[model samples]
Target chain A: MGEAIVVTSGKGGVGKTTTSANIGTALALLGKKVCLVDTDIGLRNLDVVMGLENRIIYDICDVAEGRCRLNQALVKDKRFDELYMLPAAQTKDKNAISPEQVRDIVLELKKEYEYVIIDCPAGIEQGFKNAIAGADRAIVVTTPEHASVRDADRIIGLLEGSHVESPKLVVNRIRPNMVKSGDMLDIEDVIQVLNIDLIGIVPDDEHVIKAANNGEPTVMNPDSGAAIAYRNIARRILGDTVPLMPLNQKKGAFTRFKKFLGIGG
Target chain B: MTVKSNHVTIKGIKDGLVFLLDDQCEFSELLNELRYKLEHSHQNILTGPIMHVDVKLGMRNISEEQKTLILDTLKQKGNLLIRSVETQGCVPEDEAGSSLHTLCGLVRSGQVLRHEGNLLFLGDVNPGGQIICSGDVIVVGALRGMAHAGADGNEFAIIAASYMAPTQLRIAEIISRPPDEWENRESSMEFAFLRGGTMQIDKINNVGKVRPDFNVFKGV
Candidate 1:
């Protein structure tokens, strides 16, 4: 059977949905059959992030409650033939579906898909439990802020207690300039606090928001730094040893020329 | 003339009366002698105002039932009050209930590691993580979280860490200042202890000086 990975962060507003959408799309682009499951229930946003909100006929609740078949509830991605999303129910609360039901649904999807990515909801509540119930592995998403890192540590402890094998960490929204200026926490600081294996680091890019506004994930754009980071994470998940992308961008030619003339660096 | 064995002796002290019970005699014989002394021989002393009686059992270990029997026998006398019953050569109650517990893992945020006695942690205690111990807390790694040593109010307990930056430190009931007050970046190992009801931080090397008994190891 294929492996199921859950994307979770204990705190809210830490880019769990965005990372899930991008990772799922990247895996599909890498010639793998990927199924993205949105376990947020009433607060579903993965469908909108994947640009599949308009095509959701039946949701995860319907499938769990036996109102429809699993395939019927899945919304196929418009861009990639190998990518499909099982949207969450917008009307039902997180308690509408149990962990066992989510596990069964994920097991059924694992038989057909090569990779099943579950987009977990924020907070260590019923939604988070349901998301990680059937996951073989887990990806803990966090920013470099103190609150996010603290919450990520809490989530890592819970995931380990649940026996999810050494969940990898993905530090999102890193600003290299702020880090250099000593205003924000650097990648090394976050890693030292969380004390987990780093899977990827996505630099803060304006294109992530711009692409999300257009109902497309940032991974669809090849030039964005966030896109490259997500692709590297997908490749790492596939057992590829890709080097970490450099966060510091090289100076422009004019700046270099100015620095050569002893004006500015 | 017959030689009488003195199984119990009563002494007059400044505060009250001291009862020196012979440890080498049989418990029943000692009880009988104590009863006879208090009822007949020492009846004149017991006729006055309430006198505090201190029972000193030297080199004798007795169970709770036997101690209660002594207390009851003392209570039978009208003007006698039992002050303290002390035994020699036995560990104190607080020390007897404590032990050393070793833990090797990350104590992450929202996770609490509570132990009844001393705790020896070999991993980092991240922000929001906590360690509540009754005896002492010793960390071989970074201590960035809250650690409450002497959770049961043993003020002599201490907290030691290699990297001694912590959000908060508590010894007994006294809480440390906020993180801003003692934001130490010192590379040396440090420990926290309570002195005169106030928490103090010092280098770990001086622990033996602060608490002489802290050096449990003998010579090399």
Candidate 2:
């Protein structure tokens, strides 16, 4: 049976969907049969981030509602063969389905895939309840900001009540320089508050934006800071004991900015 | 089943409500008697106080069929609280009935327990956390999350944070972000409130010479 993993964070703009796309893609690259489900009903962004919004003719809602077959709604990723995207319906609201329905769908998907990753919605409401009903494990994503970490903690607490055990934490978009300068909350501060086992730390890299615009995940890139972190995180999930790359070990920002601008720092 | 003073008494507590299921007292006959008793009682069915009926569930000398029939009858009313005479474990009053052994915080997520009086936090409210109280908010720790006092269009609400850094701080929708430049950030506890329809954070201080009308918490 596939291990069902739900990617959820109570706060918006904390990279839940982005982490879902990359982690699912990375798992597929590792030869694991992965199916990424977007549980955000009305406001869907996983399809856009995955760059498969246009190719979607049917979604998980269609399959759950019996309008389309489950096999028909699974969108194969362009980059990986084992990776698939089960998108969410944009027209209907969160009440279109129930927690039991999501569980049933997940059970059926488990028979065919080795891993099922659910991208949960932003708030802790019915949509969240439905998304978490069938998750065997969960990954709570958060930035280094106080608000994001606070929301992540609340999400963890809710997951506990829902009987989801061992939900991991993924600190995303970490900028080492700002952390060194004391401008942003460091990874340590975030980890202390949320109190979840750390799964991965993804460094903030501009290549993420460029890759997203091109409908590509940064894990495909070999040298970007975020890409390297994502790739390392993927290897860690596959049972590789890789140490986290040393962060904030760089020099001045003026020099780094020049390199980003490609002006010969 | 024999009832006295609104309390039903069974022959034995071990095997359901028993009153000799012999041919004399049929299940239908017992139902007619119970219905007559409830109809005469002075209690509203839906809109009034809930009726807590006692029931004994188990089997001893009673036949399996009789036990099932009695249990099924109790399920229909949905108002019975099964009590076991074996241990007297009546519904197991837990901390809000959570199977888990953790002290579930009284204020759960997605629920805003508004207080028209005063609200205080014993610990810090991490982000995605909020407290919208009508009076004053006193945080025991650094208030790094969002808080809005006087949410019901009352200007009397005031938000006080020890560290005073919040994602969103508001007093009746007058919002303020901690200044982008932290050099001027106050070193003491600050309270955000509305004056002339603008949110203002005045440092809490105690002094003899007629200070700024009120005192806010000071961060040492």
Winning candidate number (DockQ): 1
TM-score of each: 0.79, 0.56
Against the reference, the lDDT scores of all candidates come to 0.90, 0.71
Model 1, residue B36: distance off in Å is 40
Tens-digit lDDT track of model 1 for A1-265: 8999999999989999999999999999999999999999999999988888889899999999999999999999999999999999999899999999999999999999999999999999999999999999999999999999999999999998995889999999999889989999989989999989999999999999998888999998999999999999999999999999998766889988998999876
Tell me the tens digit of each residue's lDDT in model 2 across A133-210: 889988889998867876788788788777787788889988887987899998888875666688899888888888
Model 2 chain A poorest 10 in a row by lDDT: A230-239
**On residues B142-214, what C-alpha lDDT tens digit does candidate 1 reach at each position?**
9999999889888888999999889999988999955574664667999998888988889998897666444
Candidate 2 segments exceeding 4 Å error? A249-265, B1-220
List TM-score (chain A only) for every prediction.
0.96, 0.92
Docking class of 2: incorrect
Where in model 1 is the C-alpha error above 4 Å?
A254-265, B1-99, B179-181, B216-220
**CA RMSD of all predictions:** 9.2, 21.7
